[model samples]
Target: MQPTLTGRRIIQPPRSLLVRVRESVDFLARHSPARFAILVFTALILVWTLLLSLPISSHARSGTPLADALFTAVSVICVTGLSTVDMATHWSGFGNALIFIGVNIGGVGVLTLASILGLVVSRRLSLRARLMAASDSNASRIQAGPVNEGQAVRLGEVGNLLATVAFSALAIELIAAVVLLPRMLAHGYDLGHAVWYSFYYAAMAFTNTGFTPNAAGLTPFVHDYLFLGALMFAVIAGAIGFPVIFALVRLWRQPRRWSVHVKLTLFTFAVLLVAGTIMYIWLEFDNPRTFGDQNAFDTVFQSFFMSVMTRSGGFSTIDISDLHSSSLLVTDMLMFIGGGSASTAGGIKVTTLAVLFLAAFAEARGRTSMEAFGRRIPRDILRLAVSVVLWGATTVAVSSILLLHITKQSLDIVLFDVISAFATCGLSTGLTQDLPDSGVYVLAATMFMGRVGTVTLAAALAASTSRQLFRRPEERPIVG
Candidate 1:
């Protein structure tokens, strides 16, 4: 009996290991939200690299370099879309698949999805993840229901958040693909390729990734009524966050209660979009390569799309490199101002822009309290706005300096590339491919910064230390 019992115990190795794994998974699910996010992003890049490295990706003739894989993965996962290798020429069918996957994963935070699954099994969100999610989503409060005002979200709520993002992504991307299909198919592609192109471009465009699989993305479809409409539709939807989406839905339901953020985002977005369109049109009026021969409608349409793509989405109706110098500067400026918070787009965000602009306006008017659309802007928000602009300028300054040193290229191109990377804009002037190794490194760093975000990185560093606790009382002396 003793021998039989011992043998049975020894025979339970598989079960023991299984239990161990379950416990380990549970532990991971309950702790380390930021690290968990990093791991997920890393895994996604690996999957992308593997797919692109497959025989099918190379047309069964080997695949891209390891450096290329890592670079592409970083770009795609970050939604920067700055490719060292040409997407149209270098990657194959299988490779393009990986690129789109990266775009989707990056555009919508990966943690948003994983958090949903964890909720199903564990019924609790890790404290770290909850904080990060709250931060990333830019919500004043994460959970909608009552709780200990001191307490954060439950595991199930995290799932709800994830479901909300995923479902929104799917709905928008699918509709975009459908809208793109007919016009895209009519442009010269067969049914299969057109479908593939539509889905690829839809995912990339919807995610605001500038990566292109076809030779011409929105260029050929420049004036096509449906195509241009679809491109704008997908990209704009993405630039606006999901929370804003929910808020808008409720507003649609009731027509009276739009949140401050939603109101600000819409107003800022409209102003910028209109401003950018007109700026580009004026800048490109006679640019030979861009819109010289085009009629008024085509010129305006292309300019509008170009303006839209510069911020977050990256579909281009003309060769970005061929744009006139003035137009390039305009795009660089637009890209620096990127998309709204918690959306696929990047940058300091439109909300930040709105708040900053309001703060400026208040200062200009010599008012003590900042107000926007009759809403009182909080002091905390003002502080954040200051920090964002300071840090953003600092980052750009540093990147521009490094870029200037690394490449002998024009300062305009370097600044454009740096801002593109920092804002996660991915609009380039063909210099990304021609860049030297050092230049590549600089751009790569910017991509990482853009993806993980200036705020995330700052928070990670702050959370890792207690040094701020002992700091001397602050004093300020400034002049401008």
Candidate 2:
């Protein structure tokens, strides 16, 4: 019996620490999903680090160095393909399996994964959980104000969206595996090896993680057009974001019914794809180490492939370091822009670029509003886009400076790898493999911030926002 004041005695049961901890987690999941997501991703990285550090996970059957294990875990969990170790030979089958699992989980997204876990535990999505999941699809949902329904996933459709995420990933990977199976067999892999490699490559492609299992990397199949085509398709599917996929699936024939987010993402993605392809072909055409040795058709095809890979696919047929300096600059720009929002790919996202361009167009036209696809884009969105770009640029700049100082590497190479890490693009100029442990940790931090996203990180760090009852007088500052 427990003591009671001015009443009958009351009995209270003791609660275990585990229950208290779970309750606290649930509270965080309900109230502050962004912070919860950060915690979840951090926990996941630590778990993977421990797993990869195990003696059994390595080919040498000895524990991996802390720096390498931690960095690999970060890269895998972020779905970034950059690695300090020789990814193909350093890991045992168990280690590779852990990587495969980690990438898929990471690719699902932190908030969406949290919502899924909550749904599984409660047998349904609570409103807060729906909001958390919806925020993943449309980031504006995380803002303080009311979100425009036209551009966002509605609460009612969250379940279907979750199902779409899971189902589409499985279906796309299955198709890719089937298409790649024969190619693997043709390459002389045994049936079991063919099956495993087929599925592994399929997962890697769809997750936009460029880790290759074999020692030869993509060298063996550089000329395998069918295999490469399958990979390209999967990468595009992944980088387009699940929201776009959901919208496309439901409104494939109804273009007019498409949300502005979907329209902007697709249109910008196409423009960037073509632009990157042309730039690569123009810049690298005569470079002996890249396009010069290839015939006209192969050159164009490889240019297109590189264009896709730089969109955070992380796959490359040719040596990235051999590309011309100007080509590297172009790749840097493409990687900085990266792929679609809420997609497996990283960087500031193509949608952010589209918004900035639209705002510039509006300003040039002397219009007060940014209009796209017959709809007006909000001012807050423009602000958010600017913030994201600035944050991303700052992150890349700081990391580049730190890496340059740490490794004493050339600016071009350091900047390229830093942008690659920040964009999770995974394309490297042969610099990452030589980085010291400190440099590895810096790049790891860059990858984590890139994957968690600038917006999400900012939101997570913010303690709370206070609403004001009155407005302050507006002031104008001189323009640049």
lDDT of 2 by residue, 236-322 (tens): 999999989988989899989999999989999999999999998998989998888889999999999999999999999999889
**Tens-digit lDDT track for model 1 on 1-480?**
122347447433344678898787656544444544555676777777676666677644677676667677788888887888878877766677767776887888876655555655687766655655654566333212233221122333454566667778999889999988887778888999889888887888788886767766556766687887887898899898776775664457753466677788888988889999999889887987888888998888877888788877877777777877787888877888888877888788888888888888988999987886666877666776677767787888898898788777788888888888888877887878887777777787778777776555554444343334577879998968
Which parts of model 1 are misplaced by more than 4 Å?
Answer: 1-36, 50-56, 119-132, 139-160, 464-476
What does candidate 1 score on TM? 0.85
The top-ranked prediction according to TM-score is: 2
lDDT of each: 0.74, 0.90
- Score every model by TM-score: 0.85, 0.97
TM-score of 2: 0.97
